[model samples]
Target chain A: MLEIINPSMVSLIQSIIIILSGLVILIASIGILTFDKDMPNIVYVRIHVLGMIDVAGIVVFLALGQYMFAVMYLVLAPFLAHAMANAYFYGEDDYNTLYADDMVEDKYAALNAPDKLDDDAVEDESGEDADSAEGNADETASENLDSGDESND
Target chain B: MEILLISEYFLLVALVIFLISSMRVISYKSVAMGLIGTSSLTLAVTIILVVAGTVLGLGFFKDIALALLLLGVVGTIGFAMVLRRQD
Candidate 1:
């Protein structure tokens, strides 16, 4: 019960765990960003960092012997966030190429090459068709108005 | 206090597993692999606390159990949201 738990010891453990976990999380983030490799490696690094956060959150909760509800909420929220992010980012291809500027440029050139049907060409074609349709509609409306005037006269 | 010490030892072991499993999570591109690692870490911590409570007769197992349940719910909902948002 509350009567038996040592508040100071709990606080000390909480502080230590928080510090250690925070350091691990920090290192893991740095490693992740610097680790410019495949998706598996990236995902592994991300999970490691998340694990630190997870442990840190739990330790903090245990340390906060009284504010169980509040700490528990805080802990769950971040875990949920991390899990969602991980699953979303890693659920697809395990080896997504980290597209760099060179890759982007290459993709742009390939997609925009002459004699090929591309998104830009399709957009332009649609735009021109829309304009022509609008012009025809305007002419028809004008003719209708003129006929109406003639009938009135 | 005795329970706290036992919990600390268990947590120490859990931390070791966490650190190792974290590397696997980062290296493996599989979502399942990452989730497995996460589960291992979760289970280790939860079991440690539960065992500590039971061994010490601390009468705090209910609180720990509730926390684990809450974690499970949050994890499921979070995964669902991820699924809904996926392209």
Candidate 2:
């Protein structure tokens, strides 16, 4: 099967992949075993290490030239990670995580604020927007004046 | 080839790693850490399956690896849900 490509090169890649996958699993195992359980936010740390497991799994698939499995695993690993993450996120009543605490929404608003101001700057710079705003203001003022004239008459 | 020999050695190392991770999974005191260990265990199994398949010339092991991968994700999710409900 590998004769289509350089067999030695393919073997080298597979060897490297297996070695790397072993190292990743070893590290993940250590982290899972030795990480401080007393920390309040330990789940995130655990999840981070577990991500290496997912990466190693993908590489091992690629090493075996199973692109389809690699792609499928890639697509699904995030969902698994997110599940583990959300288990922490929604599980706590006092969940003070940033996502649950509206940090993301606030940051999103903060990020979009400058864009909003930029839109206002565009409105200020564009003659059409400025003219339309002025036109509306003038129409309101003229309507007020006409009402005053009717009252006076 | 030396590369294939080296790959077999690493595959052996990976198998050992898998055993250690499975032991680690059994040893976690905390639920969250246990979940982490579970994920690592599943992933380690997936890696070993591929390694065994490759060295043994069993192409169908890739399909089993794929199934295990999907099962890992599903199993983790299911475990997380159970944990969430308990909390």
- TM match of model 1 to true structure: 0.32
What is each predicted model's overall lDDT from 0 to 1?
Answer: 0.53, 0.71
Candidate 1 per-residue lDDT, tens place, A28-143, comes to 43454455555455544554655555555455445535355436645565565465555645455334434444588888978878766576676555545544545545435545
Q: Native contacts recovered, in order, as a fraction for each?
A: 0.02, 0.69
In angstroms, the error of model 1 at B68 is 18
TM-score for each prediction? 0.32, 0.66
Per-residue alpha-carbon lDDT of candidate 1 for residues B1-87, written as tens digits (9 for 90 to 100): 554454455454544555564465535565545554455455345544544564466767747755774786467556645753665
Name the regions of candidate 2 deviating beyond 4 angstroms.
A1-5, A92-153, B85-87
- Who wins the lDDT comparison? 2
Interface RMSD of 1: 10.1
Model 2: residue A23 alpha-carbon error in angstroms: 2.7
